[model samples]
Target: MSGLRERKKERTRQALSDIAVALFLEKGFDAVSVAEVAAAAEVSKPTLFRYFPAKEDLVLHRFADHEDEPARVVAAAREAGAVPLDALRDHVLAGLERRDPVTGLNDDPRVLAFLRLLYGTPALVARMHAYQGRSEELLADALGGADPLAARLAAAQVVAVLRVLAEENVRRITAGERVEEVLPGAVAATRRAFAGLGEGLSSFC
Candidate 1:
């Protein structure tokens, strides 16, 4: 089932990613070059290329699975006669309770540093914008292909609010606020953000 070539490739990819994150924290992401990452990971340039198509892949790969989360939440709720907004709101709140990183629940110093790295690096920000577009596309498709207008509008609003909430969480975290201290604000802010869609979400709540 598992070929030697594939297994070795996976190992090399992980090694490179591990080394890259460490270097990124130690020296800044923009300052680190592919060559340095390869050397630091004990991998050749071509080998690194085979593993990660580009330098951005190192950080982005971690976010790949999360790209589908919004869509998955919507789809799951639809089968139960729930609107997309209701579905997504429930998913967000549930994630908060679980202290999921995607919900910004674990915004400790290391996580805040990672957020700073993404914000400070121009290329990473550009890639992140691209990823946001993909997330919208996924949600739109999940919301029934009949009318894209509704899906697009809902996805845009939901994502905008979610991003703002996440940013605020990181802000509080960086300012030395604990998770418990920041949660009430986060919850209230989230409710306010979803207030316009009260009919659908209130029923779910």
Candidate 2:
């Protein structure tokens, strides 16, 4: 049936990423070839390309699920008659509490290795920036399509705040702090950051 076929395809996709990441970590991102990843995953180079269009995708594809998450949060917030900023704040707090990998709070060995691969690879970093750009566009559309500049500026500020917080979480965890130890600080930081966003900074001068 269609459902079974979809599950099988998902398994193959996941296997490819798992093999690719393992190999990339073992060696290095630029040093590894798409053909080699295909060989390790027991698929042809063309088939691997069919699943992931580029070499960078072999690693960044792990983020495919959360690619449009911020946009979705914005949309859902509007539907519920709530402001996007509040929704974003709550969503981020939940991720921190759960230590979501996307939030960079997970300290699993594999996750640490994967983060190293991403941060150390220039190609992956560039590709990640492209992804973030697209995310900002989607969020801008959700916020308002009338004024592109305003929407984009708002999205950029929001995304930048969350990205820094997540990276800081990764840094502390890598330095041996447990998620529990970081959660309180993360919660306080989120509240303060969002509050600053809600209140204009003109008076600070």
Candidate 3:
């Protein structure tokens, strides 16, 4: 049945992700090839590509949660007569309340090492930029018919702020700061980043 096959496919994908993470942890991501991952997961390279179009997706897919977030929040706010940017700000800051381990907030050595690898490698760094460009495109669509130029400029600025905040959190944690200690600055950055937007777009927020 389609349902049974779908479940099996999901299991295979999870297996690949798990094995890939383990391998990346053992041997740096840059050192591992798709062939090795395919061998480890007992699948062909084509099969792996069927699940993830790119090797970077194996790791950075975890970071693409916000691709549709802004659009969703904007829609919800409009439906509730809430302001767009303000709603977006609230939605974002609220999401940050969770110290997602994927955010490099935990004391796990593997996670820290992975973060180091991502920052150290030029290819991964370029991949991150490419992902950002894609995300901004999604945000542009979310902006709907708003002032086109303003919407795009606003979306780019928000994404940039978020990227900086995430990088800062990772750096602080790597420097031996606990998540709790890093929380204030992270929240403060959110507020600072949105304060102007919130005020400027008060009518829409």
Off by over 4 Å in 1: 2-12, 197-205
Candidate 2 lDDT, tens digit per residue, 1-205?
9999999998988889989999999999988988899889888999999998889988888998777898899899889988778888899989887778888888788887788788778999899888888887887788775667877888787777777887787778778887788879888988998898777521210
Off by over 4 Å in 3: 1-8, 101-110, 199-205
In terms of TM-score, the best-performing candidate is: 2
Candidate rank order under lDDT: 2, 1, 3
Off by over 4 Å in 2: 1-7, 200-205
TM-score of every candidate: 0.84, 0.88, 0.84
The alpha-carbon root-mean-square deviation between model 1 and the true structure, to one decimal in Å, is 3.3
The candidate scoring highest on lDDT is: 2
Query: Candidate 2: deviation at residue 108, Å?
Result: 2.0
Candidate 3 collision pairs: 83-204, 83-205, 84-204, 84-205
Evaluation by TM-score, superior candidate among 2 and 3? 2
Models, CA RMSD each: 3.3, 3.4, 2.6
**Better model by lDDT: candidate 2 vs candidate 3:** 2
| Model 1 C-alpha lDDT versus the unseen true structure | 0.75
Give residue 145's error in model 1 in angstroms: 3.8
lDDT score, residue 178, model 1? 84
Residue 118, candidate 3: how far off, in angstroms?
3.0
